[model samples]
Target: MNPLHVDLGVTGSVLDVVRAPAGVLSTPSPPVDPTAPEVVQLAADLVATMRVSPGCVGLAAPQVGVAAQVFCVDVSAHPKTRTSHGTFVLCNAEVVEASRNERAREGCMSVPDLTGDVKRATRLVVRGRVPLTGAEVTVTTDAFEARALQHEIDHCAGLLFLDRVAGAHALHQRQTYL
Candidate 1:
């Protein structure tokens, strides 16, 4: 475990909802260059933050103010998923293939306590390099895993779950953490 500090700067501020550029909603930016140190560090930071978050399974770089194509997800390491497969740290991940067959509720740290329902791919195949060794790997996520990956990827592009909510009125009120 490469130790890291999960630093979420100035929590509780409202996050901006990034809209898809005129022609880029359907096509996302390419993954980060795995050889880059910035990408590696962002992955580390993401892991650090997720480890400390309650029920958090994944995170993206842009959510941390780095617009690079890096993110970290570790569903297995979470004690909540003791019977699950395990944890992983991905850098420069790209969603190669996905099936748009479901819609589910989603939320984000950037967006604070507001939660909303959004449509998403039920399954996804993400290809990227392992942050620890820079080796190439492809991970196929389903169910919650798929949703988590999608949520993080959206962050990389400056998009947030609240932007995709079908019913704006259903959006939850942001509550105080303490």
Candidate 2:
């Protein structure tokens, strides 16, 4: 164990992603105990699912049918990423600070069919506990990493990109998958 990070045992098997129209996807998720065995398993599942989901850079516990405040994100491979941190899983994440707003097209694994224009902070400082170690860590990041973090954090709060779209006109059906 890294002392500051819990060994959540990352797996590669894909888990079925829960879609919209499911009540859980829209309901607020409760915080999980950082050290709980179930939470540890969830952290693993989240990473696995995100790895297998196409065009996915992030995922939330609620997206997987678990109403818990946990999310996994990896923007390192994304071409748009400017400050990559590889992959990170955070439990009960809080956006302690945010600045510099920018508008961009956003999509979610849970809302796979629809994409929308959303305004998000270009820089962010997030605080959360490492589930396995119960270690509190703060991340300061910008660009694509920051956007991914905000999107996943929104999932923890039961909000989706759809809710953040500028207008109904801002929403669009995704035309490309690549």
Candidate 3:
């Protein structure tokens, strides 16, 4: 099912992307609260959001103003993400290990209208639990797909591409990202 339709928030043009601030759960405990129905629904909504948005390879809850550590990604179908097996569900994901000596251009749903060359691992091994079944899944990604996954993971932590920019002119426009 497409989860993009659940109205997580704005499509977030270049202007609105950085305007968003990350949310805090206040409790010392894990904010994910995996058992909450809203958390479940947010995961569902993210899947739909990823499905409907053109060129969106991944999305994080914080990108939509939600503090939960939930995100959705579909790289198999994307023309640029040939290394992906298919769509994936990630919850409380973390980059376990990443290969060095790799760099690639990246984009984001939150930071639309521009792309930038970011230094990232050509390959990565990510560890996380599936939001739906709560099963652990380890995904190994390389090249563009790796960048895409890393990009979304960063969002879960409230970091934007601008934070990675090396220079003011690093941003470049993309006619189409889908």
Candidate 4:
């Protein structure tokens, strides 16, 4: 079964996105019960927020001021995307496998002014639970979808692209938003 094709079965309201330097963004989020009512709602909320935000492919619970290991991702429409899993939410996600590190520019809604060159795995396998069903699933992907998954996972771990940059020289001022 395609784990990415999830039906949250609940309406979600868009929540305010928290900015960088906010304690929640820096503080590690705790693993959540995937099937719990609140976790399911939070998963839906993350998806809703990501959809409403232009150029956003993923969103984590911490970005919405929730300190929980939950996130949603969708990269189907991105020009850089090679393999997409569509939209999906996961709880307690972790990278089970990764390889082929490549440096690429990354931006965050939490830190709107800067983009950083961070090395991330181009191929990845992530393991996590589906939010509504608590079904454990493994996602194997490459290219932009892999990068998007890693970015959201980092947010769950209290790290930003800034934390992954090689140095200040690798950072660039954002002139425009995609």
Query: How would you encode candidate 4's per-residue C-alpha lDDT over 84-173 as one tens digit per residue?
Result: 989999899999999999999999999999999999999999999999899999999999999999999999999999999989999999
Model 4, runs deviating above 4 Å: none
Q: Pick the candidate with the highest lDDT.
A: 4
- Superposition TM-score, candidate 3 onto the true structure: 0.77
Worst 10 residues of 1 by lDDT: 2-11
Instruction: For candidate 2, write residues 1-178 as lDDT tens digits.
Output: 3333455765545678888878887888998998898888888888888887777899899998889999888898898989976777899999999999999999887887789999999999999988788789888899999999999999889898998998999999988746
Local distance difference test values of all predictions, in order:
0.63, 0.86, 0.66, 0.93
TM-score of each: 0.71, 0.93, 0.77, 0.97
- Tell me which residue pairs clash in candidate 1: 76-86
Better of 2 and 3 by lDDT: 2
CA shift at 83, candidate 4, in angstroms? Answer: 0.3
By TM-score, is 2 or 3 better?
A: 2
Clashing pairs in 2: none
Q: Which candidate number has the best TM-score? A: 4
Q: For model 3, what is the error of residue 69's alpha carbon versus the real structure, in angstroms, after optimal superposition?
A: 0.8
Write the residue-wise lDDT of candidate 3 on 1-178 in tens digits: 4322233332322212233333421211133754356776777677767777766777777766666688777787766665864666677788998987465677776666777867888789998776535656788878777887787777776677767878767778967636
